[model samples]
Target: MAYRKVHQIIQSHSSADGDGVRIQRVHGFDNPHFSPFLMIDELKSVSPDDYVGGFPPHPHRGIETLTYMLSGHFQHKDHMGNVGELRDGGAQWMSAGNGVIHSEMPMMTDGQLHGFQIWINLPAVKKKDPAQYHDFQTEVIAEKTLPDHSLVRVIAGDLTIKGDTVTGPLQQTGVPLTVADWRTQGAANISACLNPEYQTMVYVYKGTITIGGKHIEQGQLALLSEGEGLAMAASDAAGVLLLSGTPINEPVVHYGPFVMNSMDEINQAIEDYQNGTLV
Candidate 1:
């Protein structure tokens, strides 16, 4: 396995959306090569007027979305007839195997609204599978206290440290995918062991992080080559999103919202969605 230096650093930008909601896109709509992991959006608001109203109906296909809430409350409804609410520290994971229509809106009583939405890609073989949904409350996720008392949330994989294992919701995706969330109080340093065969990356969400002697600030993403995991140290109180998965080495053909291995596949996906055959 080879280790490569951080290649790019870009700040997330804000964009206006449905019902006065503001979304800061961290990735996607730009880089198309980040297979497996596609996009991330950080949404925030404080005033009731700014966040009480939220996103309405939308459509998705050939992707999986993970929504993590830091504060306030939001509810999701889908065409498949599924509905759920997410509060502080809650997460909603939806697999849009072939196609699905859904909507998410913030429900505010009197607090701020802040959260993130991350997109993951499915392998070609599973792109046509049925859609599914899973919601994890704050208490359902695995949390571990580090040696320095920092808290780490295991969202979807395993992390081993000093003979102790921290596990998250285990889902079999046919392809290997690992994702986790970490929060540090004050200053702390921690390292995660990773499989040498998997491609990995980290996204800074709240504060600053130094990896391989390079500092990354909030909203910037770092792509890492296959190798020994990552060594991260927080300069202040911070939070980070860690993701790793088996690389889809095949050629990628993406258009609008669909990702396929070839142009023919892309055309077929579009036709299926239009013909009401993709679901």
Candidate 2:
């Protein structure tokens, strides 16, 4: 298999979203190579003051959102009567197709509050489709244990190692995507492969890891060049998130929480949201 090279490294910038909730904004509305995948927000806070005020109600269109909780609790409620509670190690996926109004509120008062929220864009063909939601508790999500006591959790894609396979819970529709988290123990290496044509990148969340001969530390993202597979080695205990997607190669116009093909579409989205049709 041809191994990809780390072409670019991006450091996260701190930003606030969801009603004063602070987070490390990794990538949003930037980096075209990460197409189909728009944003990656890392929320890690131990103080209740940093995460208490949650998103009350918001409208999103022409995109999909995935929230994975590491140590905190998040409750998701939508206008469609879907209520999902995400605790530690749990995840929630929402497809805001044509449009949807929802809110994600943190339920933790104290202790460790950490997780990630990822935004994936929808192609023009599927932008007008209906919205959907998929919620997964901690135990229901698929996970794999490597020989080195490392762990890999599949959130929306299938992963296989040494003839053992684990498939994620969510079945996506547009521009087939893969999102998984990998944890490696000291000096442990794991083998992984992806489609050569797909846009692939890795985000280091904890500790340090080496990918394509490049050392990546926490709070940084490594954008990989075209390749089929690679070995992810950790000098110390490390955790990383693997993200890849099939490119749509279409014009992406993003405004606030809406992503569409053109300015006209963006305007239409705004009109829909303003008219209370975004549900």
Candidate 3:
């Protein structure tokens, strides 16, 4: 019953990415231990001008990009001829193993446009594999309700609480991973069993939550120390996203959207994209 403690609390930074869309970036560059998992960005906009341009065609290699839409609509088209629309509660997981060119455009002009896009690194051995995509609509996602009226949406992997298991639609991954959005009400005990081998991070985007007796609120991310699980409490209505994954533990080189095992690989990727050989 060893519990994971909060190692560090990070405040998200405001940044622009993918066609200049404003977003709240939790982490990406400079943290090597967060291996297989590379970055996390939250895009939430109430103003149409803030997110209308959207992400145009772009190239990526040696990584996986996951897009989860919480509100509004997004149409995703890629070089693979995959045309997918992510509506409320839908997600698109793209494994840009070797290379892939894609674009995500918003379908709405007004109202709230919100979602998350995460970048995950690939191991050197699989870096040159063919690109692929896994799409999941809202109805396919799994969810669970705790005794205290708390709700947890299982986006990937599994969540075990007091011997009950809630599995997500994403069953296979390059590395073991778990992702979920949890909501809690009033003073409540929040618990989730996890693998001690994986790196864990929790981002509280709404309301307030406490971990290891420290309070964290909107724009804050908590890095959980190595342990088998999490056992904490939230004193108020709160919403947070929990992410955990096994570290790749290898040399990582990156330049913009391309991530590779060496400088040479990065150079090769750039050459491939420029020559229109990357798809």
Q: Rate the local accuracy (lDDT) of all candidates.
A: 0.76, 0.86, 0.84
Q: What is the lDDT of residue 109 in candidate 2?
A: 34
Model 1 stretches with alpha carbons more than 4 Å out: 1-5, 17-20, 28-33, 48-53, 263-277
**Candidate 1 vs candidate 2: which has greater lDDT?**
2
Please give me the total number of clashing residue pairs in predicted model 2.
0
Q: Write the per-residue lDDT of candidate 3 for residues 175-250, one digit (tens) a residue.
A: 7898888878776766889988889888887788887788778888888888897876777888888888888888
Instruction: Give per-residue lDDT, candidate 2, residue 78.
Output: 93
Candidate 3, lDDT over the whole model? 0.84
Considering every candidate listed, which one attains the maximal lDDT? 2
Q: Could you give me the TM-score of model 2 versus the true structure?
A: 0.96
List model 2 lDDT by residue over 135-163, tens digit each.
99989889988888999999887666665
Q: Report the lDDT tens digits of candidate 1 across residue range 75-149.
A: 999889999998898888888887887888886535678888887777778777888887889998888899887
RMSD of each: 2.6, 1.3, 1.5
Off by over 4 Å in 2: none
As a whole number from 0 to 100, the lDDT of residue 61 in candidate 3 is 95
